[model samples]
Target: MAHLGQVELLTPELDATVWFFTEILGLTETARTASSVFLRTFDNYERTSVIVTRHHTSGLRRTTLRAASDEALHRRVAALEAAGRPGRWIDGVAGTGPTYLTADPDGHEIALYHQTEWYSAPAHLRPGLKNQPQAKPRQGIGVRRLDHVNYLAADVLPNVEFFEDTLGARPTEQIQLDSGKVSARWLTFTHKSYDIVYTEDRSGANGRLHHIAFATDTREDILRAADLCLDNDVHIETGPHKHAIQQTFFLYVYEPGGNRIELCNPLTRLILAPDWPLITWTEAERAKGQAWGLKTIDTFHTHGTPPLD
Candidate 1:
């Protein structure tokens, strides 16, 4: 499984969104273009991420991440097609080395591709690279690298089939919740133990992001970062709790525009053996931290959680 490595957000307000990640949530500015700025958690986190694009409406209009090669990319696209899903590839997108466009439940576009060496940038953009003074004490927050992504779909079946058969990501867990006569099922995907996850929607925007998390070195750093968000009045969605798989204490903080950002520690262990069989989740396992009638199921287990459930 070639797991997800980073997530990029396209928003209208670049300055506001960047400030939220930098000052409030503590991310480092790795690279910046006239129209885009990328903040990373560390040099190795997601190869420089959290792209904020200047636009009119503030939301994730598009997203692009990594894949091993063009062959893998074609394999993924073919899988979606076989499952009776719609997907296409962009011949080439400037700034982003290469990419393919795919749509989710809310019709938001996702571009999956690999970047050229031009993207192997160092994360130390201090003392101001583009003629600006360096900001405050964020040595802990400088751009890390790509970690993983969590996406919400129209339904789980299409996404599960597309991801599993195409990209080689396998299910870490599956959730089914019953609310009166209606029941919902969601899927989790991992190159090893989930780099992307999707579930049913209960309200608000369709194709809206629930959250995207990056990994940290120590639980101390993660908790400290969460405190920074609270001090800055960034919304605290949830946090400082132990997950079933990764087992790391994590803090899920919402950015300036209500987009959830997770700052977490590395999983207790890494599933480095790519061929390791994907484990399934029991009913109680999937229901952890969930209630009936609530559509959200935390099937994801790679971002600072364990996998021995």
Candidate 2:
């Protein structure tokens, strides 16, 4: 079911963030109204997009991805009903299949837009940062798209249950550590390895966002994105390492309001089989899978060179 077309972002400052994407990240303003703005990856309608909404409480809100087909999408809808997380299906937008919006316990809404077509268009029509209306964003990073978003829930289990049960999202990688005595967990998604991520960190003022990841198309693009942080004074906490499990290259950038965003690309893709085994790791084995930091943060952070980072 490799039909995830794009992710949507619902933010409080619709107009401001829209300006951020267009002027800063080089996206073209495809459509806009008084309450919302739709940005194309480039000029094309089929490419990925980010939606800015007028409602605001936290910084970033809704996120969406495409479903592989109509049947697959409805199957997911059935799963959602079985799991008791009810949501309404909206008419498909963006030439995407039957779309829907689901809410988390905290009431943050995530939309799923499924494009029924299993096809590709001309490469030029796809969105790229070649002709941005704005020069560059303030903290100017070359982010391709809002790759993944992480959240901090009271317990990630219920949140995990919703995605795994309803959306057919599974943990490609996950870990657990006793949060003192309460048993906390951290997990990653299988769809783009980004379906859902939960951390127990109560460090933020509002306490929802953990981090967001952006996909950089190439190793060169990845480095250029990291450079945006350095050049524009964005606080980069760490990374640009390869992970043994995902085999993807990644780095972290600190944005305003204590939230984090990851820049990543150039990784191997794993196909999900019917009975794909769920591998759980003990702390010891996790360290090994982490490659003792070879393609991970430990290697680069310890080296203090920040070259690959």
Scored by lDDT, the top model is: 1
Winning candidate number (TM-score): 1
Tens digits of per-residue lDDT, candidate 2, 1-309, equal 333345445455455556556544556555667876766543223544555556543245556666666677677777777777769978765446667777765555666765643324344443245453222222334455555566665566666666666766666555654342222233334435444565543332222565566565577766776676576676666655665545667777644333355677733455456455554445554456443464334422221110111
Per-model CA lDDT versus the true structure:
0.56, 0.53
State the weakest 10-residue window (summed lDDT) of model 1. Answer: 300-309
lDDT, candidate 1, residue 142? 34
Give the alpha carbon lDDT tens digit for every residue of 1-309 in model 1.
344544557565578778877765556666788988866543432345566767654445565646777777676667667766677667644345556678754565667776534433334544344333333345444323345565555455665655556666555545544432111222234433456666544442356565577766567777777677677777776666665544445677656544667776655555566455545445555555532223232433222110112
Cα RMSD, each candidate: 7.5, 7.5
Q: Could you tell me every candidate's TM-score relative to the true structure? A: 0.72, 0.68
**Where in model 2 is the C-alpha error above 4 Å?**
1-16, 42-48, 54-56, 91-98, 115-146, 178-194, 201-207, 243-245, 255-259, 269-275, 283-309
Candidate 2's TM-score: 0.68
